[model samples]
Target: MNRFRYSSHNLYSLLSQPKSPLHPPTLPSQTLVSLDPSSIDFSNSNQFHTNSSCSSTIPSVSSTGSCPDSALASPFSIKFRSLHLYRGGYIDKGLLVNLYLVKHHCYGTSSSVNQCGFRNVGVNELRYFASHKQVRDILGMIRRKDNDLESKVRSMNVSLNLKMCSRFFEELNNQKRDALAVCDWIRYAHPSCRNDVHSMVIDNLGRLGNYDAMARVLSEFAKKKVRLVPLAFEFVSLSPLKEATVMKVVDVLKAVEEPTRGSGLCSLIKMFSAVGSFDMAELVMQLSERKATFYKIMVVEKCGKGDFEGAADLVEVMRKHGLKPEAKIYNYVLSTLCKHDKSAEAGALFEEMLASECAPDPITYEIFVCHSCKAGNFDLARKLLDRMNAQGIEPRVSMHGVILKGYFNLKRFEEAYEYVMACDRYICFPAICSTLARLYVKADNVIVAHNLLLELIDRGLRPDQSVYTNVFRRLIDTGRTALAEDLRSRLSSIGSKSTMGAG
Candidate 1:
């Protein structure tokens, strides 16, 4: 899951000096040659040629026969075995996994047992690591518009598949134009999957609320007379709708023939309702047949705007239309009632939801717990937390944080500490621990806060940088220069980015 950031300086480091225990015993003809991936000019086909004197140290490969055609067999072939890649003073799992593949490819089904009996890193384990690295490298090349990108990929024997391209596209920063460039390359490389790739672009644009870029893409598709993909509309269904964006969508839909255009209009209606444009959405919905869906979305929007009565009235309207409201619709109303101090009404509605066969979800309980904490009713919040556990619904960390904040507000530090400790060990405690440390610092108990922060670090929990910075600044002001510097170094080692530079 780790996306490696590559640089020329550390692209490939020399690990030629063999280490005992980690490295296998030397063979008669085997000599290790580290391939510095960054230094190789992948545009040169000759770069893949094997040196006659050199032989793979990897077991099962005979020292004879022309070395496996080092040139990329196809766009997807990767020379995983030829490179010794290392970063940050440790062997990456990618190298180990590729080495496993090399041995397997050499051994084939001749034997499940490794002939050389090397320690198995498990077959195909960390395979994605190597593939991700190669994909990222290609993405980087594309970003720089490197003319050698195609040659490099083919020369390095790296495989570019649709999945890898999609992942790299998702990881691209929220720059739509940059994503568009990548999308074009993907479309050219994978003509068969053009719609799927375009869907990704539209999803990214909608997720970022970049309607301008989305409009351009839609316009280009219309110009090309490409049929609008149904999936694109699905992605944009929850996006915030604007007049200009909707117009562009309408223009594109005019070209796409029936059925799909009909589906697209439905999604457009949902998009409008999602953004609280209920009146406009209702007008659009007149062209569609999904009355129930539109009503549900409106109820949620009404609750969001704190119009509890309006949301409740919409629920009655749904029932009149023979559409049963879901737990989510009731939950929104409950949340609004609680927010408006209508706790009695919320309680009644909760009972009604249960009676109507609408099972309460995690959010239903979360709403009550949050209200209880805000009302300073710790007893009720604690009971609600227990009920959530009894119902097999795990309370999120934010809920615990909320209760802890309540205790800290009442200056009940002992109870807060005990409560956190009593919670399951599996529950993440960094945020809770950070809140405690910050409280100590706020009370002018700098030494206690500093000590607590150190203990949390030893427990492998990272405190927020704000608390660390505060303690560091306090230490300096108190003339404890060495202590202040040590804290700063510790912060740097933890890789926490601080707002202020070390002073």
Candidate 2:
């Protein structure tokens, strides 16, 4: 009998039953003390926008262009007036809506729409609720009843549905609107006890990478004298943190007094590394030595900022501390050096990568190949390319395009055929295909560029307008305007204008 032991109590794991359909799994139970609505305040909320006109907040002056007599009106062409304006003026579209307006005026249906039956409603109904301006207006009307315009809205009070709260989060996060800005407009303006919206606001603040903002939100959660503020501490790992601010956080964290994780301490080291504050990083590193993440980030950031000397110093520090730098770590350093036009330094780093236990990735070898060709180090580039192939890391066509150009530039016409042969499809990316097309244009081989572009499109690689423009320009310049015109039609079908300056 097979003797492998497995826990049997949780049969639901085998069934893969969903935990929650309506919401994501809960975070650590938020212990935030509820503030009275009167205590909730933001002075910035009333600051009128300087760029806005008192008369109208509609961003653009209306287009006077009318449809020609011969043209039919577009089904999708809806008027773009500033929403909820009597004529054209910015006023509070408070968050309450009359149930009657939503029931009757929304769809010309007279039926009363009361409580949303399900918290997470049907998708078809959601799509309508999301797109239809009437629901948006209703939610907008539900904001602060204190606004003079919304005084009437207070008479017919309505709280936002959970679904609508989720929608607000969606829009704000998309715009990357400041968390406090969203709070001032929605939560503070129209207070709700919904944990979902509050948690979402805090989470979004965390993601946007402001340590102070995170700390402010978490302070309301509870001052802990034992465990670390897990959520508040995440943003500290993000680089470019001011030293003065970080020190303040460090002091506050000490006061809140938690058993600190080594990883958390390491994040401070990383922030120092990002800003090239090596002394600060070293101070933290002296407290602990196994932080591989801290070392890796320092090398990449130093190289990116063109402090090759600092990056080299970090590598030496890594070795001195017995921390083994990984392959991808070396890849990042190599990419940064090559980007900054330090090919010789990049080549030197490549040698170190090879000598060390870290295997050079395809990206490392390819970058060396591209710049080596540009620098006229043809032999070195070719040797590196052969080593890259030997490693059995699949050659990207983007990388190969560099070598192909090198061959063309060297007048190695005989070798060109061998380079253009089919490569492994299992690992090929659409980016390489785009690169190949662009390379053909540079070589004045318009026919190949045109055919390859069509092939890419046929294989479900959708090029953006910029890609279309690049190829179209090349084709037009090369007197392949007929072919360019054909591609233009395809581009136009996707709503990209190909004739703006194709000449």
Candidate 3:
């Protein structure tokens, strides 16, 4: 027996009828909640009722008297269904569609769409109702070795565009084999979009650190005479591939136009320099006109390895090349020197940077301020903040925290309290306030902490949860139940407002 009481055609046809004037349209049941109309796959109608236990018939409207209140409360159950019609039409069309997709497409229940008279419905119809999140989830299933789902999609012969493929690639989470398989699927489904897919796949593989596979794919692209873009090599510079493998990729990329080739080779120079292959870096540097860019990359790598002397040498080399070294290069070396307690060296470099007319940017000032705060030189840190203000550079809220914490660290409670009070609204970030609240509590100044929490509330800022809990607890512990209760109420209000704003 055909267990389903109604055919797909019968169900959709009956729902399309105009609602009779005597019977009003009622909201759908709670089961319709969380249903995404766009994700419903209509490819298989027989799978709709494959669950044998679901063979029971729908009850008529007269039996229930009216739509149940449970259905009325669902926010998503807005679609209306006529109660006086056949039981098949009594439920919202969206509900029926969602049930079909969940069973057949997602859960992999086996049945024949042809048997259900839905053979004419193609994957395109299913895709019309599918969301991007659903597509990503399908790709994610393929990544987790769900061969059945993969086979199902293959049978459907679905085609995705460049944007869709790029999104699906991100959801692969660096699964190299899955990326290739999905790319192959795309190539089969849409041959014209293969070139775009190639760029995405190569870039993804590079990020996955699978350059041997990337090189093979690059060679294929070369054979196809597909034009390469600079973005294709974006992540290759960070990959830890063998020198030979890197060279193999570089050789295959020779077919790329000169402009792209130059940019691509510069990325390789960064890779070589980062891996301590300076000789190879220099050799590759000779192949590109962006020698200054190559110098910057090498300087950063040298600084990362704590070779400040080598980085400075690179700066001198750039000068010799008639390329004025930027503040970025100086800041990189300056940050490293300060981190390593070579403050005197950093100060000299700062002066030299000034002499070289590399007008110190905000980062340049921040570096010195951070270093001074760390070294217990609050006076110099304050002077830097003043200089930043004089130059109209807004001091970063983080710098305020650094200076405030420096005072707290040295047990200068009076100074820390005064500093927090003196700061304007822009400087009083919630994190800084939280840090000060914590420090004050630790110093047995619960009253100040309590007051700071109130002020934060007045400024419409929610304190960190831990700080909120700590202050609220301290209030109760000090026999101030009324204040604690009031604080709890205010925090709850803030949370409610935040939730509403998000909604």
Candidate 4:
């Protein structure tokens, strides 16, 4: 089945030249604009109420990914023709079968990524993409070790082939075959693949209780003249750290003429630290002061285990050890806190960044604002926006859109209306303005809504016929015949009614 796609670019064109900012319109003598959405009987399939206004509130707003229920026609809604419904969660028949029949799940298929397919896509993930005959053949080749098919797999994307081959090797019982499969993929499928592949093989061997083969694989990888990736040290730690293995791994690390490249030595320290060889990790760290990121890695590891306090302590330890934490390191910690909704802790981390003189960048502030808005705390979000402006960082449209969305979500329409009015200059996108106007018209604030619609015209964003007709109809119904007639004449002057919404 084809999927829906939406773009931020305007869907309508301007029919007339930009006008001056719209002055407030005169109200009708009689308050006759009925906004009680329930007054209209939505049960009658043939019944179309002019005052029926059911809205998810924001149109042209990006779909939140999750779907929502569409209500009966609301007087405020100006939809041309669109009805969203999940067809019992069914898709194309062939694609549906393809989803379940492959060897490994292809979690990253172009369409399935957006669909509710399994995430992480290991073990059974190949099934998702193996619907392709060539893909299935590649999977078969990897399993059967058909060396002749190497070129075929190589022709595919490097990352993709690597994933399939890696999955193939992981299910192997023989360590030598596993090692051979990885080498086969690298030598044929993607000779230019990074040392991470070799490390992956070594890690796999260790997981399979084949330390001897793991050591052999490491030796073989070392024989290659290419630079070893940081993952080399990681896999070494994965294998047994016996006298021979430890010495072998240490020799590899020490023999490297360039220790800083790819943070090889730092990775060694991290591996040692990760494997409970902290004392060795520290001793190895003494060989290089460029272990700032590794220090953060340890902090991150702490955060992963829910030891946020320990993570913070690790930062202080970093200072004591003469390792300066960069803004990026602090950012990782801050973002993690925000992700976990630890707002109080995130605030502290921000203060700590300022205190440490590790200047926070625009990204740091943006994360804070996004999380704040997502939590529906518009007050904090607004304050953050103000703080960003005070710091000379211009606010982003995404942030305003988020805050406005929060107001609409909370059903705080009055506040949302006032906020929209306050930022009309910045909220210049025709779609968003029209959406807000629709909301206003639904709420019986037709005059305010009409003013906003005119404001769009002045800003050079002329909404189409549906929007114009809807507003005009509401205006006439509310006894504002003068304003309605004037608008009708203005639209007719250019003969633009037919051209409106044409886009």
* Candidate 4, 1-503: lDDT as tens digits: 01112223211011011322323333333422324332221112121235323333221111233312321221211111111211222233433233234312332223332243323323321122333565566556656766565566555534334565556555443323555544554544333365556556655554455656654555555556444454545445545554345554554455444422334556666666565565565555555444677777676666666666666776778888777888777777777877887655666667666778887776777777667666665665666656666777655544455555555555555565566556544433454565566555555667766776666565545654465777899999989999888776655555433222211
**Model 3 / residue 95 / CA error / Å:** 19
Q: List, residue by residue over 1-503, the lDDT tens digit for candidate 1.
A: 01122233220111111221222222222211111112222112121222232222332323331223231111112433312221122233443444555542221112222343333433322222225556667767756666555565445433244686676665654333346645665554444466566766666666665667776776676555454444565444554554545555566555555544554565566555666667666655543344666676777778877777777777777776677888778887887887887765666666657656777787788888777776677777777777777888876656676777666555555566567656635345554565555555555556655665665666655666566777777878878788778766665575544222111
lDDT of 4: 0.52
TM-score of 4: 0.48
List TM-scores for all candidates, in order.
Answer: 0.43, 0.44, 0.51, 0.48
lDDT of 3 by residue, 1-503 (tens): 11113333331222233432222213223211111122222111121122222223332111213322222111112221111112222345443444334331221111332222222233322222234665766766767767565565566644455676666667664554536755666665544456566666777776676766766666666656665543465455555664555565666556455444554576567656767877677766544344667788888899999888888778877887788999888989888988987665676676667767887787888887777776677767776777777877876655676777666555555566556656644444565666667656555556677777777777677776676677788888989899889888877676544311000
Off by over 4 Å in 4: 1-164, 167-186, 190-198, 201-238, 242-289, 321-323, 335-344, 366-377, 424-457, 461-503
Q: Write the per-residue lDDT of candidate 2 for residues 359-471, one digit (tens) a residue.
A: 76677677766666665555565566566667777765557667656655554433443344344242453444445445444455556556656665655554433445667
What shift in Å separates residue 446 of candidate 1 from its native position after superposition? Answer: 3.1
Error of 3 at 460 (Å): 8.0
Query: Alpha-carbon error at 49 in model 1, in Å?
Result: 46
Worst 10 residues of 4 by lDDT: 8-17
The model with the greater lDDT, 1 or 4, is: 1
Task: Output the TM-score of candidate 1.
Answer: 0.43
TM-score of model number 3: 0.51
Winner by TM-score: 3
